[model samples]
Target: MRKIFTTIVAGLLFAVPFTAMAQVNILACEPEWAALAEEIGGPKISAFSATHARQDPHHIRARPSLIAKARRADLIICSGAGLEVGWLPILLQKSGPQVQPNALGHVTASHYVPLLDTGAGVDRSMGDVHPEGNPHIHLNPHHILPIAAQITDRLAQLDSANADYYQNRYQDFAQRWQQALAQWEAKAAPLKGTQVVVHHKSFSYLIDWLQLRAIASLEPKPGIPPTSSHLESLLQQLKATPAKLILRTPYEPEAASLWLSSKTNIPALVLPYTIGGVAEAGDLFALYDATLALLLENANVE
Candidate 1:
Protein backbone atom coordinates (compact mmCIF):
# COMPACT_ATOMS: atom_id res chain seq x y z
CA MET A 1 0.00 0.00 0.00
CA ARG A 2 2.94 2.37 0.71
CA LYS A 3 4.51 1.61 -2.69
CA ILE A 4 1.18 2.09 -4.46
CA PHE A 5 0.61 5.50 -2.83
CA THR A 6 4.20 6.56 -3.62
CA THR A 7 3.81 5.56 -7.30
CA ILE A 8 0.59 7.56 -7.67
CA VAL A 9 2.18 10.66 -6.09
CA ALA A 10 5.20 10.36 -8.41
CA GLY A 11 2.96 10.18 -11.51
CA LEU A 12 1.00 13.28 -10.42
CA LEU A 13 4.23 15.23 -9.76
CA PHE A 14 5.50 14.31 -13.23
CA ALA A 15 2.23 15.56 -14.80
CA VAL A 16 2.22 18.94 -12.99
CA PRO A 17 4.32 20.93 -15.50
CA PHE A 18 2.37 19.61 -18.51
CA THR A 19 -0.95 20.22 -16.82
CA ALA A 20 -0.01 23.81 -15.90
CA MET A 21 1.07 24.58 -19.47
CA ALA A 22 -1.98 22.98 -21.13
CA GLN A 23 -4.72 25.53 -20.53
CA VAL A 24 -4.26 28.87 -22.31
CA ASN A 25 -6.71 31.68 -21.55
CA ILE A 26 -7.69 33.50 -24.76
CA LEU A 27 -9.69 36.74 -24.70
CA ALA A 28 -11.43 37.33 -28.02
CA CYS A 29 -13.02 40.72 -28.74
CA GLU A 30 -15.94 39.14 -30.60
CA PRO A 31 -17.68 35.79 -30.96
CA GLU A 32 -16.06 35.04 -34.34
CA TRP A 33 -12.55 35.15 -32.91
CA ALA A 34 -13.72 33.10 -29.92
CA ALA A 35 -15.09 30.48 -32.33
CA LEU A 36 -11.87 30.48 -34.36
CA ALA A 37 -9.77 30.12 -31.20
CA GLU A 38 -11.82 27.10 -30.24
CA GLU A 39 -11.23 25.62 -33.69
CA ILE A 40 -7.45 26.15 -33.46
CA GLY A 41 -6.78 25.85 -29.74
CA GLY A 42 -9.12 22.85 -29.25
CA PRO A 43 -8.98 21.41 -25.72
CA LYS A 44 -5.67 23.17 -24.99
CA ILE A 45 -7.19 26.63 -24.59
CA SER A 46 -10.06 28.33 -22.80
CA ALA A 47 -11.58 31.05 -25.00
CA PHE A 48 -13.86 33.93 -23.93
CA SER A 49 -15.53 36.55 -26.13
CA ALA A 50 -16.14 40.09 -24.98
CA THR A 51 -19.10 40.65 -27.27
CA HIS A 52 -21.91 38.33 -28.25
CA ALA A 53 -23.38 37.87 -31.75
CA ARG A 54 -26.46 39.95 -30.91
CA GLN A 55 -24.49 42.96 -29.69
CA ASP A 56 -23.15 45.89 -31.70
CA PRO A 57 -19.36 45.57 -31.70
CA HIS A 58 -18.95 49.32 -32.24
CA HIS A 59 -20.87 50.60 -29.22
CA ILE A 60 -20.01 48.02 -26.54
CA ARG A 61 -18.75 49.35 -23.22
CA ALA A 62 -15.68 48.08 -21.37
CA ARG A 63 -17.27 46.43 -18.36
CA PRO A 64 -15.42 45.41 -15.17
CA SER A 65 -15.73 41.70 -15.87
CA LEU A 66 -14.11 42.24 -19.29
CA ILE A 67 -11.24 44.08 -17.63
CA ALA A 68 -10.79 41.11 -15.30
CA LYS A 69 -10.84 38.73 -18.26
CA ALA A 70 -8.21 40.81 -20.09
CA ARG A 71 -5.94 40.93 -17.04
CA ARG A 72 -5.88 37.13 -16.79
CA ALA A 73 -5.72 36.44 -20.53
CA ASP A 74 -2.74 34.65 -22.04
CA LEU A 75 -3.58 36.29 -25.40
CA ILE A 76 -6.02 38.86 -26.75
CA ILE A 77 -7.50 38.42 -30.23
CA CYS A 78 -9.59 41.16 -31.86
CA SER A 79 -10.90 42.38 -35.21
CA GLY A 80 -8.85 45.59 -35.03
CA ALA A 81 -9.04 48.15 -37.88
CA GLY A 82 -10.97 50.18 -35.31
CA LEU A 83 -14.01 47.95 -34.98
CA GLU A 84 -13.61 47.89 -31.20
CA VAL A 85 -12.02 51.33 -31.01
CA GLY A 86 -14.64 52.53 -28.58
CA TRP A 87 -13.94 50.06 -25.76
CA LEU A 88 -10.77 48.00 -26.47
CA PRO A 89 -8.45 50.90 -25.68
CA ILE A 90 -10.13 51.34 -22.31
CA LEU A 91 -9.83 47.61 -21.59
CA LEU A 92 -6.17 47.54 -22.63
CA GLN A 93 -5.42 50.61 -20.54
CA LYS A 94 -6.88 48.90 -17.50
CA SER A 95 -5.39 45.43 -18.24
CA GLY A 96 -1.75 46.71 -18.32
CA PRO A 97 0.95 45.94 -20.91
CA GLN A 98 0.43 42.20 -21.20
CA VAL A 99 -2.08 42.45 -24.08
CA GLN A 100 -1.28 45.83 -25.52
CA PRO A 101 -1.23 46.56 -29.24
CA ASN A 102 1.79 45.23 -31.26
CA ALA A 103 2.57 42.67 -28.52
CA LEU A 104 2.83 38.98 -29.44
CA GLY A 105 0.09 38.30 -26.93
CA HIS A 106 -2.14 40.78 -28.79
CA VAL A 107 -3.34 39.49 -32.15
CA THR A 108 -5.56 41.42 -34.53
CA ALA A 109 -7.39 39.60 -37.35
CA SER A 110 -7.31 42.73 -39.56
CA HIS A 111 -3.51 42.53 -39.61
CA TYR A 112 -3.72 39.11 -41.29
CA VAL A 113 -6.48 39.76 -43.82
CA PRO A 114 -6.54 42.09 -46.82
CA LEU A 115 -9.00 44.87 -46.03
CA LEU A 116 -11.41 46.50 -48.47
CA ASP A 117 -12.86 50.04 -48.75
CA THR A 118 -9.64 51.58 -47.55
CA GLY A 119 -8.32 55.11 -48.30
CA ALA A 120 -11.78 56.56 -48.74
CA GLY A 121 -10.67 59.84 -47.10
CA VAL A 122 -12.92 59.10 -44.16
CA ASP A 123 -13.54 61.71 -41.47
CA ARG A 124 -15.63 62.03 -38.29
CA SER A 125 -18.44 63.26 -40.50
CA MET A 126 -18.40 59.88 -42.21
CA GLY A 127 -19.83 58.26 -39.11
CA ASP A 128 -17.58 55.49 -37.76
CA VAL A 129 -15.54 54.77 -40.86
CA HIS A 130 -12.39 52.81 -40.01
CA PRO A 131 -9.38 54.72 -41.29
CA GLU A 132 -7.46 51.43 -41.48
CA GLY A 133 -10.32 50.12 -43.68
CA ASN A 134 -13.58 48.23 -43.31
CA PRO A 135 -12.96 46.24 -40.12
CA HIS A 136 -15.69 43.73 -40.85
CA ILE A 137 -13.15 41.38 -42.44
CA HIS A 138 -14.69 38.36 -40.72
CA LEU A 139 -17.71 38.57 -43.01
CA ASN A 140 -15.47 37.26 -45.77
CA PRO A 141 -14.96 33.50 -45.54
CA HIS A 142 -11.66 33.78 -47.47
CA HIS A 143 -10.14 35.77 -44.60
CA ILE A 144 -10.68 32.98 -42.05
CA LEU A 145 -7.75 30.75 -43.13
CA PRO A 146 -5.13 33.47 -42.72
CA ILE A 147 -6.65 34.71 -39.47
CA ALA A 148 -6.69 31.13 -38.14
CA ALA A 149 -3.03 30.69 -39.19
CA GLN A 150 -2.03 33.92 -37.48
CA ILE A 151 -3.95 32.88 -34.36
CA THR A 152 -2.20 29.50 -34.38
CA ASP A 153 1.17 31.25 -34.53
CA ARG A 154 0.20 33.48 -31.59
CA LEU A 155 -1.03 30.45 -29.63
CA ALA A 156 2.31 28.70 -30.23
CA GLN A 157 4.23 31.85 -29.29
CA LEU A 158 2.41 32.33 -25.99
CA ASP A 159 2.27 28.64 -25.12
CA SER A 160 5.34 27.10 -26.75
CA ALA A 161 4.98 23.83 -24.89
CA ASN A 162 1.75 23.13 -26.81
CA ALA A 163 3.08 24.40 -30.17
CA ASP A 164 2.75 21.09 -31.94
CA TYR A 165 -0.71 20.53 -30.53
CA TYR A 166 -1.91 23.95 -31.73
CA GLN A 167 -0.44 23.46 -35.21
CA ASN A 168 -2.07 20.06 -35.59
CA ARG A 169 -5.46 21.41 -34.59
CA TYR A 170 -5.01 24.40 -36.93
CA GLN A 171 -4.16 22.10 -39.84
CA ASP A 172 -7.24 19.99 -39.21
CA PHE A 173 -9.39 23.12 -38.90
CA ALA A 174 -7.88 24.54 -42.11
CA GLN A 175 -8.78 21.38 -44.03
CA ARG A 176 -12.35 21.37 -42.75
CA TRP A 177 -12.70 25.13 -43.25
CA GLN A 178 -11.53 24.88 -46.86
CA GLN A 179 -13.98 22.07 -47.51
CA ALA A 180 -16.76 24.14 -45.94
CA LEU A 181 -15.80 27.17 -48.01
CA ALA A 182 -16.17 25.16 -51.19
CA GLN A 183 -19.62 24.08 -50.12
CA TRP A 184 -20.60 27.68 -49.23
CA GLU A 185 -19.32 29.00 -52.55
CA ALA A 186 -21.28 26.38 -54.45
CA LYS A 187 -24.39 27.11 -52.42
CA ALA A 188 -24.02 30.87 -52.85
CA ALA A 189 -23.26 30.67 -56.58
CA PRO A 190 -26.74 31.86 -57.46
CA LEU A 191 -26.41 34.89 -55.20
CA LYS A 192 -23.63 36.41 -57.30
CA GLY A 193 -24.50 39.93 -58.45
CA THR A 194 -27.64 39.80 -56.34
CA GLN A 195 -28.43 43.39 -55.42
CA VAL A 196 -29.00 44.14 -51.75
CA VAL A 197 -29.67 47.16 -49.57
CA VAL A 198 -27.88 46.99 -46.22
CA HIS A 199 -28.26 48.78 -42.89
CA HIS A 200 -24.52 49.41 -42.62
CA LYS A 201 -21.30 48.69 -44.48
CA SER A 202 -20.75 45.81 -42.07
CA PHE A 203 -21.46 43.20 -44.74
CA SER A 204 -19.01 44.66 -47.27
CA TYR A 205 -16.63 41.70 -47.16
CA LEU A 206 -19.41 39.15 -47.42
CA ILE A 207 -20.96 41.03 -50.35
CA ASP A 208 -17.57 41.23 -52.02
CA TRP A 209 -16.92 37.52 -51.54
CA LEU A 210 -20.33 36.44 -52.87
CA GLN A 211 -20.23 39.01 -55.69
CA LEU A 212 -23.39 40.66 -54.36
CA ARG A 213 -24.06 44.23 -55.43
CA ALA A 214 -24.78 46.64 -52.59
CA ILE A 215 -27.06 49.29 -54.04
CA ALA A 216 -27.66 51.42 -50.93
CA SER A 217 -27.27 51.45 -47.18
CA LEU A 218 -30.16 52.44 -44.93
CA GLU A 219 -27.67 54.32 -42.84
CA PRO A 220 -26.38 57.13 -45.05
CA LYS A 221 -22.92 56.56 -43.57
CA PRO A 222 -21.23 53.79 -41.63
CA GLY A 223 -22.45 53.57 -38.01
CA ILE A 224 -24.96 56.38 -38.53
CA PRO A 225 -28.55 55.62 -37.67
CA PRO A 226 -31.01 55.79 -40.54
CA THR A 227 -32.89 59.07 -40.72
CA SER A 228 -36.28 59.69 -42.35
CA SER A 229 -34.78 61.89 -45.08
CA HIS A 230 -31.92 59.44 -45.73
CA LEU A 231 -34.29 56.51 -45.99
CA GLU A 232 -36.46 58.47 -48.38
CA SER A 233 -33.48 59.13 -50.65
CA LEU A 234 -32.37 55.48 -50.41
CA LEU A 235 -35.88 54.32 -51.22
CA GLN A 236 -35.97 56.54 -54.31
CA GLN A 237 -32.52 55.37 -55.43
CA LEU A 238 -33.25 51.68 -54.86
CA LYS A 239 -36.47 51.80 -56.84
CA ALA A 240 -34.53 52.56 -60.00
CA THR A 241 -32.13 49.62 -59.46
CA PRO A 242 -34.58 47.35 -57.58
CA ALA A 243 -32.69 45.61 -54.79
CA LYS A 244 -33.98 42.13 -53.98
CA LEU A 245 -33.69 42.37 -50.22
CA ILE A 246 -33.01 44.78 -47.38
CA LEU A 247 -30.48 43.15 -45.04
CA ARG A 248 -29.47 43.79 -41.45
CA THR A 249 -27.60 41.83 -38.78
CA PRO A 250 -29.41 40.53 -35.72
CA TYR A 251 -28.02 43.31 -33.53
CA GLU A 252 -29.33 46.07 -35.83
CA PRO A 253 -32.79 47.49 -35.19
CA GLU A 254 -35.40 45.94 -37.47
CA ALA A 255 -37.59 49.02 -37.86
CA ALA A 256 -35.54 50.66 -40.63
CA SER A 257 -35.14 47.50 -42.65
CA LEU A 258 -38.78 46.60 -42.17
CA TRP A 259 -39.91 50.11 -43.10
CA LEU A 260 -37.75 50.04 -46.22
CA SER A 261 -39.07 46.57 -47.07
CA SER A 262 -42.66 47.74 -46.70
CA LYS A 263 -42.06 50.88 -48.78
CA THR A 264 -40.08 49.11 -51.52
CA ASN A 265 -41.94 45.76 -51.57
CA ILE A 266 -38.60 44.00 -50.88
CA PRO A 267 -38.27 41.42 -48.13
CA ALA A 268 -36.28 42.36 -45.08
CA LEU A 269 -33.72 39.68 -44.15
CA VAL A 270 -31.84 39.40 -40.87
CA LEU A 271 -28.50 37.68 -41.44
CA PRO A 272 -26.78 35.67 -38.72
CA TYR A 273 -23.77 37.92 -38.90
CA THR A 274 -21.59 35.79 -36.64
CA ILE A 275 -21.60 32.87 -34.23
CA GLY A 276 -24.84 32.84 -32.21
CA GLY A 277 -26.34 35.66 -34.27
CA VAL A 278 -29.24 33.31 -34.92
CA ALA A 279 -30.41 30.01 -33.51
CA GLU A 280 -28.77 28.16 -36.44
CA ALA A 281 -25.48 30.10 -36.16
CA GLY A 282 -24.24 28.32 -33.05
CA ASP A 283 -20.60 28.16 -34.25
CA LEU A 284 -18.31 29.34 -37.05
CA PHE A 285 -19.36 26.61 -39.47
CA ALA A 286 -23.02 27.06 -38.67
CA LEU A 287 -22.57 30.83 -39.01
CA TYR A 288 -21.76 30.73 -42.73
CA ASP A 289 -24.18 27.89 -43.25
CA ALA A 290 -27.02 29.93 -41.79
CA THR A 291 -26.04 33.17 -43.58
CA LEU A 292 -25.87 31.57 -47.02
CA ALA A 293 -29.03 29.63 -46.41
CA LEU A 294 -30.88 32.81 -45.46
CA LEU A 295 -29.56 34.67 -48.51
CA LEU A 296 -30.61 31.86 -50.84
CA GLU A 297 -33.98 31.56 -49.20
CA ASN A 298 -34.73 35.25 -49.60
CA ALA A 299 -33.25 35.49 -53.08
CA ASN A 300 -35.93 33.01 -54.21
CA VAL A 301 -33.32 30.94 -56.03
CA GLU A 302 -34.68 27.43 -55.70
Candidate 2:
Protein backbone atom coordinates (compact mmCIF):
# COMPACT_ATOMS: atom_id res chain seq x y z
CA MET A 1 0.00 0.00 0.00
CA ARG A 2 2.89 2.42 0.84
CA LYS A 3 4.60 1.58 -2.43
CA ILE A 4 1.41 2.42 -4.36
CA PHE A 5 1.06 5.79 -2.63
CA THR A 6 4.75 6.65 -3.25
CA THR A 7 4.44 5.79 -6.97
CA ILE A 8 1.29 7.92 -7.36
CA VAL A 9 2.96 11.00 -5.85
CA ALA A 10 6.03 10.45 -8.03
CA GLY A 11 3.85 10.33 -11.13
CA LEU A 12 2.07 13.55 -10.22
CA LEU A 13 5.40 15.40 -9.83
CA PHE A 14 6.58 14.26 -13.27
CA ALA A 15 3.29 15.21 -14.99
CA VAL A 16 3.09 18.75 -13.55
CA PRO A 17 6.19 20.15 -15.35
CA PHE A 18 5.12 18.85 -18.77
CA THR A 19 1.75 20.51 -18.40
CA ALA A 20 3.52 23.70 -17.33
CA MET A 21 6.01 23.56 -20.21
CA ALA A 22 3.46 23.59 -23.03
CA GLN A 23 4.20 27.10 -24.26
CA VAL A 24 4.82 27.69 -27.99
CA ASN A 25 8.19 28.83 -29.35
CA ILE A 26 7.94 31.90 -31.53
CA LEU A 27 10.57 34.45 -32.61
CA ALA A 28 9.27 37.71 -33.95
CA CYS A 29 11.64 39.89 -36.01
CA GLU A 30 10.12 43.14 -34.82
CA PRO A 31 8.74 44.48 -31.53
CA GLU A 32 5.21 45.15 -32.81
CA TRP A 33 4.73 41.59 -34.04
CA ALA A 34 6.28 40.25 -30.88
CA ALA A 35 3.75 42.15 -28.78
CA LEU A 36 0.82 40.85 -30.82
CA ALA A 37 2.11 37.28 -30.80
CA GLU A 38 2.44 37.34 -27.02
CA GLU A 39 -1.05 38.77 -26.57
CA ILE A 40 -2.68 36.28 -28.93
CA GLY A 41 -0.51 33.39 -27.81
CA GLY A 42 -1.43 33.90 -24.15
CA PRO A 43 0.58 31.59 -21.88
CA LYS A 44 1.10 29.06 -24.65
CA ILE A 45 3.94 30.84 -26.50
CA SER A 46 7.35 32.39 -25.93
CA ALA A 47 8.06 35.34 -28.21
CA PHE A 48 11.33 37.27 -28.55
CA SER A 49 12.24 40.30 -30.63
CA ALA A 50 15.48 41.06 -32.52
CA THR A 51 15.15 44.81 -32.10
CA HIS A 52 14.20 47.27 -29.39
CA ALA A 53 11.90 50.32 -29.26
CA ARG A 54 14.78 52.72 -29.90
CA GLN A 55 16.03 50.70 -32.91
CA ASP A 56 14.78 51.12 -36.46
CA PRO A 57 12.87 48.06 -37.64
CA HIS A 58 14.10 48.75 -41.18
CA HIS A 59 17.76 48.11 -40.34
CA ILE A 60 18.67 45.32 -37.88
CA ARG A 61 21.85 43.35 -37.35
CA ALA A 62 21.64 39.62 -38.08
CA ARG A 63 23.45 37.96 -35.21
CA PRO A 64 24.19 34.24 -35.12
CA SER A 65 22.37 34.01 -31.82
CA LEU A 66 19.28 35.52 -33.39
CA ILE A 67 19.56 33.04 -36.24
CA ALA A 68 19.64 30.20 -33.71
CA LYS A 69 16.49 31.54 -32.13
CA ALA A 70 14.90 31.90 -35.54
CA ARG A 71 15.90 28.36 -36.29
CA ARG A 72 13.92 27.19 -33.30
CA ALA A 73 10.86 29.33 -33.99
CA ASP A 74 7.80 27.51 -35.28
CA LEU A 75 6.69 30.75 -36.91
CA ILE A 76 8.61 33.87 -37.98
CA ILE A 77 6.66 37.16 -38.20
CA CYS A 78 7.94 40.32 -39.91
CA SER A 79 6.63 43.77 -40.88
CA GLY A 80 7.07 42.88 -44.57
CA ALA A 81 6.56 45.37 -47.48
CA GLY A 82 10.36 45.64 -47.87
CA LEU A 83 10.67 47.40 -44.53
CA GLU A 84 13.07 44.74 -43.35
CA VAL A 85 14.60 44.35 -46.82
CA GLY A 86 17.85 45.51 -45.29
CA TRP A 87 18.32 42.66 -42.78
CA LEU A 88 15.56 40.00 -42.68
CA PRO A 89 16.87 38.37 -45.85
CA ILE A 90 20.19 37.66 -44.22
CA LEU A 91 18.45 36.04 -41.23
CA LEU A 92 16.32 33.96 -43.59
CA GLN A 93 19.37 32.73 -45.46
CA LYS A 94 21.28 31.90 -42.29
CA SER A 95 18.42 30.20 -40.45
CA GLY A 96 19.18 26.47 -40.53
CA PRO A 97 16.74 23.59 -41.03
CA GLN A 98 15.85 23.87 -37.38
CA VAL A 99 13.80 26.96 -38.23
CA GLN A 100 13.02 26.18 -41.88
CA PRO A 101 9.31 25.60 -42.29
CA ASN A 102 7.94 23.44 -45.01
CA ALA A 103 5.63 25.44 -47.31
CA LEU A 104 2.83 24.46 -44.98
CA GLY A 105 4.87 25.14 -41.85
CA HIS A 106 6.30 28.57 -42.72
CA VAL A 107 4.33 31.79 -42.25
CA THR A 108 5.06 35.36 -43.47
CA ALA A 109 2.75 37.88 -41.76
CA SER A 110 3.29 40.48 -44.50
CA HIS A 111 1.35 38.34 -46.96
CA TYR A 112 -1.48 38.61 -44.44
CA VAL A 113 -1.43 42.44 -44.64
CA PRO A 114 -2.73 44.67 -47.41
CA LEU A 115 0.08 46.22 -49.41
CA LEU A 116 -0.40 49.89 -50.32
CA ASP A 117 2.08 50.71 -53.09
CA THR A 118 2.60 47.38 -54.94
CA GLY A 119 5.08 48.99 -57.34
CA ALA A 120 2.72 51.83 -58.28
CA GLY A 121 4.81 54.55 -59.89
CA VAL A 122 7.73 53.38 -57.76
CA ASP A 123 11.22 54.77 -58.38
CA ARG A 124 14.63 54.89 -56.69
CA SER A 125 14.65 58.67 -56.93
CA MET A 126 11.88 58.62 -54.33
CA GLY A 127 14.52 58.32 -51.58
CA ASP A 128 13.98 54.82 -50.04
CA VAL A 129 10.32 54.50 -50.95
CA HIS A 130 8.72 51.08 -50.66
CA PRO A 131 7.18 50.38 -54.06
CA GLU A 132 4.85 48.44 -51.79
CA GLY A 133 3.26 51.54 -50.29
CA ASN A 134 4.48 51.90 -46.68
CA PRO A 135 5.80 48.95 -44.67
CA HIS A 136 5.26 50.89 -41.48
CA ILE A 137 1.52 50.28 -41.44
CA HIS A 138 1.74 49.01 -37.87
CA LEU A 139 1.73 52.66 -36.86
CA ASN A 140 -2.02 52.55 -37.34
CA PRO A 141 -4.15 50.61 -34.87
CA HIS A 142 -6.67 49.70 -37.55
CA HIS A 143 -3.88 48.11 -39.53
CA ILE A 144 -2.64 46.36 -36.39
CA LEU A 145 -6.01 44.68 -35.71
CA PRO A 146 -5.74 42.53 -38.83
CA ILE A 147 -2.16 41.64 -38.07
CA ALA A 148 -3.19 40.57 -34.56
CA ALA A 149 -5.96 38.43 -36.00
CA GLN A 150 -3.45 36.84 -38.36
CA ILE A 151 -1.14 36.04 -35.49
CA THR A 152 -4.00 34.39 -33.63
CA ASP A 153 -4.81 32.28 -36.69
CA ARG A 154 -1.22 31.13 -37.10
CA LEU A 155 -1.00 30.21 -33.44
CA ALA A 156 -4.16 28.15 -33.85
CA GLN A 157 -2.65 26.44 -36.87
CA LEU A 158 0.61 25.66 -35.09
CA ASP A 159 -1.04 24.50 -31.87
CA SER A 160 -4.49 23.42 -32.83
CA ALA A 161 -4.95 21.39 -29.66
CA ASN A 162 -5.18 24.59 -27.60
CA ALA A 163 -6.62 26.57 -30.47
CA ASP A 164 -9.84 27.44 -28.68
CA TYR A 165 -7.99 28.99 -25.76
CA TYR A 166 -5.95 31.14 -28.12
CA GLN A 167 -9.03 32.08 -30.10
CA ASN A 168 -10.86 33.16 -26.96
CA ARG A 169 -7.95 35.38 -25.90
CA TYR A 170 -7.79 36.96 -29.35
CA GLN A 171 -11.50 37.71 -29.35
CA ASP A 172 -11.27 39.27 -25.93
CA PHE A 173 -8.26 41.35 -26.96
CA ALA A 174 -9.91 42.53 -30.18
CA GLN A 175 -13.09 43.56 -28.40
CA ARG A 176 -11.11 45.46 -25.81
CA TRP A 177 -8.96 47.00 -28.52
CA GLN A 178 -12.01 48.18 -30.42
CA GLN A 179 -13.46 49.71 -27.30
CA ALA A 180 -10.17 51.51 -26.65
CA LEU A 181 -10.21 52.84 -30.19
CA ALA A 182 -13.63 54.36 -29.66
CA GLN A 183 -12.52 55.99 -26.43
CA TRP A 184 -9.33 57.36 -27.96
CA GLU A 185 -11.27 58.87 -30.83
CA ALA A 186 -13.70 60.50 -28.40
CA LYS A 187 -10.83 62.04 -26.43
CA ALA A 188 -9.08 63.19 -29.58
CA ALA A 189 -12.17 64.45 -31.39
CA PRO A 190 -11.22 68.00 -30.60
CA LEU A 191 -8.06 67.69 -32.68
CA LYS A 192 -9.81 66.67 -35.85
CA GLY A 193 -9.13 68.95 -38.83
CA THR A 194 -6.05 70.34 -37.06
CA GLN A 195 -3.03 70.88 -39.33
CA VAL A 196 0.26 69.17 -38.39
CA VAL A 197 3.67 68.59 -39.98
CA VAL A 198 5.01 65.03 -40.09
CA HIS A 199 8.67 64.19 -40.49
CA HIS A 200 7.81 61.11 -42.54
CA LYS A 201 4.74 59.99 -44.47
CA SER A 202 4.39 57.16 -41.94
CA PHE A 203 1.25 58.46 -40.26
CA SER A 204 -1.18 58.76 -43.19
CA TYR A 205 -3.47 56.17 -41.66
CA LEU A 206 -3.47 57.83 -38.24
CA ILE A 207 -3.71 61.25 -39.85
CA ASP A 208 -6.65 60.11 -41.94
CA TRP A 209 -8.29 58.49 -38.94
CA LEU A 210 -7.97 61.69 -36.98
CA GLN A 211 -8.78 63.92 -39.99
CA LEU A 212 -5.64 66.04 -39.60
CA ARG A 213 -3.95 67.95 -42.40
CA ALA A 214 -0.25 67.33 -43.07
CA ILE A 215 1.25 70.65 -44.07
CA ALA A 216 4.77 69.39 -44.97
CA SER A 217 7.30 66.53 -44.73
CA LEU A 218 10.86 66.94 -43.54
CA GLU A 219 12.13 64.67 -46.28
CA PRO A 220 12.44 66.39 -49.64
CA LYS A 221 11.43 63.09 -51.28
CA PRO A 222 11.10 59.42 -50.45
CA GLY A 223 14.31 58.13 -48.81
CA ILE A 224 15.84 61.60 -49.05
CA PRO A 225 16.99 63.36 -45.87
CA PRO A 226 16.16 66.94 -45.06
CA THR A 227 18.20 69.36 -47.16
CA SER A 228 18.73 73.10 -46.91
CA SER A 229 16.41 73.74 -49.85
CA HIS A 230 13.68 71.50 -48.43
CA LEU A 231 13.96 73.01 -44.95
CA GLU A 232 13.74 76.55 -46.34
CA SER A 233 10.67 75.63 -48.37
CA LEU A 234 9.02 73.83 -45.41
CA LEU A 235 9.70 76.69 -43.02
CA GLN A 236 8.22 79.08 -45.54
CA GLN A 237 5.16 76.86 -45.93
CA LEU A 238 4.70 76.56 -42.15
CA LYS A 239 5.11 80.30 -41.71
CA ALA A 240 2.57 80.97 -44.40
CA THR A 241 -0.02 78.48 -43.10
CA PRO A 242 0.99 78.13 -39.44
CA ALA A 243 0.93 74.40 -38.59
CA LYS A 244 -0.17 73.66 -35.02
CA LEU A 245 2.28 70.83 -34.31
CA ILE A 246 5.10 68.71 -35.74
CA LEU A 247 4.68 64.94 -35.42
CA ARG A 248 8.03 63.15 -35.44
CA THR A 249 9.09 59.58 -34.71
CA PRO A 250 11.72 58.75 -32.12
CA TYR A 251 13.85 56.94 -34.69
CA GLU A 252 14.07 60.10 -36.83
CA PRO A 253 16.83 62.70 -36.45
CA GLU A 254 15.80 65.32 -33.90
CA ALA A 255 18.14 67.90 -35.49
CA ALA A 256 15.93 68.39 -38.52
CA SER A 257 12.81 68.20 -36.35
CA LEU A 258 14.26 70.77 -33.94
CA TRP A 259 15.38 73.01 -36.78
CA LEU A 260 11.98 72.83 -38.43
CA SER A 261 10.17 73.38 -35.13
CA SER A 262 12.40 76.24 -34.11
CA LYS A 263 12.13 77.86 -37.52
CA THR A 264 8.35 77.52 -37.65
CA ASN A 265 7.75 77.99 -33.91
CA ILE A 266 5.74 74.76 -33.93
CA PRO A 267 6.69 72.35 -31.13
CA ALA A 268 7.88 68.97 -32.37
CA LEU A 269 6.06 66.14 -30.61
CA VAL A 270 8.32 63.08 -30.58
CA LEU A 271 6.22 59.92 -30.57
CA PRO A 272 6.96 56.21 -30.46
CA TYR A 273 6.00 54.58 -33.73
CA THR A 274 6.20 51.04 -32.27
CA ILE A 275 5.86 49.11 -29.02
CA GLY A 276 8.43 49.78 -26.29
CA GLY A 277 9.41 52.99 -28.07
CA VAL A 278 8.72 54.72 -24.79
CA ALA A 279 7.94 53.60 -21.25
CA GLU A 280 4.31 54.55 -21.69
CA ALA A 281 4.31 52.71 -25.02
CA GLY A 282 5.52 49.57 -23.28
CA ASP A 283 2.46 47.66 -24.50
CA LEU A 284 0.02 47.90 -27.40
CA PHE A 285 -2.71 49.77 -25.49
CA ALA A 286 -0.30 52.29 -23.99
CA LEU A 287 1.17 52.86 -27.44
CA TYR A 288 -2.09 54.23 -28.80
CA ASP A 289 -2.70 56.09 -25.57
CA ALA A 290 0.68 57.81 -25.81
CA THR A 291 0.12 58.70 -29.46
CA LEU A 292 -3.31 60.18 -28.73
CA ALA A 293 -1.95 62.01 -25.74
CA LEU A 294 0.70 63.69 -27.85
CA LEU A 295 -1.67 64.58 -30.68
CA LEU A 296 -4.29 65.92 -28.27
CA GLU A 297 -1.69 67.91 -26.35
CA ASN A 298 -0.40 69.72 -29.43
CA ALA A 299 -3.59 70.18 -31.45
CA ASN A 300 -4.59 73.80 -32.05
CA VAL A 301 -8.16 75.00 -31.62
CA GLU A 302 -9.58 78.08 -33.28
Best by TM-score: 1
Pairs of colliding residues, candidate 1: none
Q: Write model 2 residue lDDT over 1-302, tens digit each, in one string.
A: 99999999999887654323367787777787888888888778998888877777766788888877876777788777777777777777866653443343345556666655455677656656666677776766777778787777777776777778889999999999999989988888898889888887767667877888887888876567789888898888877888888887778778888988887788899888778777899888898999888777667563
lDDT measured at residue 200 in model 2 versus the true structure, 0 to 100: 74
Which ten contiguous residues of candidate 1 have the minimum total lDDT?
A: 13-22
The top-ranked prediction according to lDDT is: 1
Which 10-residue span in candidate 2 carries the lowest summed lDDT?
A: 98-107
lDDT of 1: 0.89
Q: What is the C-alpha lDDT profile of model 1 across 1-302, one tens digit per residue?
A: 99999999999888655524558899999999999999998888899999997899988989999988999888999999989988999889877676898888899889988889887678666565666789989989999999999999988877877788889999999999999999999989999989999998889999999999998998877878899999998888887889988999989999999998998899999998999989989889999999998999898756
Root-mean-square deviation (CA) per prediction: 2.1, 3.5
Q: Candidate 2 local accuracy as lDDT?
A: 0.76
Q: Estimate each model's TM-score.
A: 0.93, 0.87
